[model samples]
Target: MTFRTLLMASTAAALLAPAAQADVNIYSYRQPELIQPMLDAFTQETGIRTNIAFLNKGLVERLQAEGDRSPADIILTTDISRLSAAVAAGVTQPVDSAVLEENIPAAFRDPGDQWFGLTTRARIVYASKDRVDPAEVTTYEDLTDPKWQGRICTRSGTHPYNLALVAAVIHHHGEEAAKTWLEGVKANLARKPQGNDRAQVKAIWAGECDISLGNTYYMGKMLEDEEQQDWANAVNVLFPEFQNGGTHVNVSGIAMTRAAPNRDDALQLMEFLASPRAQALYAEVNHEYPVSPTTEASDLVQSWGTFTPDDVNLMDLAALRGTALRLVEEVDFDG
Candidate 1:
């Protein structure tokens, strides 16, 4: 064969040689835009291409159905319940990573290493700066006081965020106290739990309510939107605590699927997410507190002021989620 033909043949063969297999497939419950930047950074740093399937619901069932044939290497999601469910469903395998251990706190990770939290967001109170005295709402327990009747607002009680908070209440004070607290909070709502966290702030601005329950990050989101900036401006972020513990908080976390096709590449991506660089990106994009002690929260989040997060194990919150939902129904929290 001619030299030119031989060289062309060799080049074509090299180009078609299965592409070196540098990709990690992810089954994610987190929204694409919120996680895309960090995934891009991971790819840029490590050259491991990311293939993600964003699912709003049914991730666990889907993973179970795929079984051993699943192409997913990682499961990315928010809320401890989903992470814990993945483990209970036997769809995740334990990871023993020194990098993960060093970066994530024990409370933020599964004891068996089945999952790891990347960031935390506090469930806090947003009180009207113009009409409400911050002193009137110093604790989650205080929101139930008759003095605040018809003065509070919130999203549905069934939202994963509120369910986690209710679960925390159960973990701290027992099921009975949690049920009572749920009913009390319900009795005080200005309107039947009607809108999202930001909408609750808008309600406060519109004089529809004086205080509302929300995640700290929503305040940052509201501030970034011109229409919602006024709503954000009308409220002061309040870090209400448990009567005996710190503020209730939730997380966005990661897990390795049981059928990981690229174990080494998946491990690299998991460790990268736990690193300071990825933690900082989480803080920047989602306005959440970094799970790593070495990473700092964004300045805007810091400006909202800081508070002590409750030391309750997130797994406990996940464990009690069923009871929390039942209590929400018992109280007719949305009705």
Candidate 2:
């Protein structure tokens, strides 16, 4: 069957899967199908009814408008910026869960207890196996080499993927260096940024560019893809100079609403999401690395090999949003 068909079928099962239970309600920015399985599994094990309101946009505003009457128990989103936006908007609360703290690594979770990550995805380089030698391409810093000029492809700078990456640079090297890196990268793009992560891979295959930066899971999707698996097959996954520590890691995380009607159930869901059992599902089914230290990668993820993730604190990356955005504008990165 087609991927659209598969996505549709998965979404149906997830939405109806939890209708029978009645204890928890979630206002999620995640698509219904992507996160519903965890909810269904959580409900089956604990009998907590989960009601999810899935929206790709406007969740923060919706929560704010609802205020005290909000039926939201938890908020789920796919990036540090989105989760941080929720916390900054006062829509989330400081959760006091030792179980959660222990399950997720300190590097992945919010220091203030406002948000907890469930899964992580590495933002690494995909170099043309034939064109770029593995040893010479060490860290993200190497991307600036004039030898590889006019051979990079990326999605729009406005994209969250690049924004978070920019934030990461700011975290590791400071704003000035980050700005320089951004300018260097922009100068090297083979074409103006336009498509998603997968498209960058496709460009490499078409000989449009020799390198791209994309999440690890997109590699899995491409290989599994019937029409476009070659998008992934065209290049090799390289974690870039992690010997300094590791590549930069980011997460798709969740938080509890300050006025959650089902606090206990929300807490249970958070705890369950971080459990090894639930975490394995993320890697196996969706291709994201589990944030839980206890969870082993599925065979698919294990095939990608492991590397040390950058030790930069997640909070600092989240706090750099404004500086990152301003730099993006200053560089005319979108153009």
**Top model number, TM-score:** 1
Clash count list over all predictions: 0, 6
| Candidate 2 least-lDDT 10 residues | 11-20
Off by over 4 Å in 1: 1-22
Best by lDDT: 1
Name the runs in model 2 displaced over 4 angstroms. 1-21, 242-245
Q: TM-score of every model?
A: 0.92, 0.90
Candidate 2: residue 92 Cα off by (Å): 0.7
Q: Across residues 10-57, which tens digit of lDDT does each residue of candidate 1 receive?
A: 532332234254378787887667888999999999988876666778
Q: In candidate 1, which residue pairs get closer than 3 Å at backbone N, Cα or C atoms, i.e. clash?
A: none
lDDT of 1: 0.89
lDDT of 2 by residue, 156-213 (tens): 8877777888888787778898889888888888999988899888889999999998
Return the clash pairs for model 2, or none. 21-49, 22-49, 23-49, 138-241, 222-229, 246-308
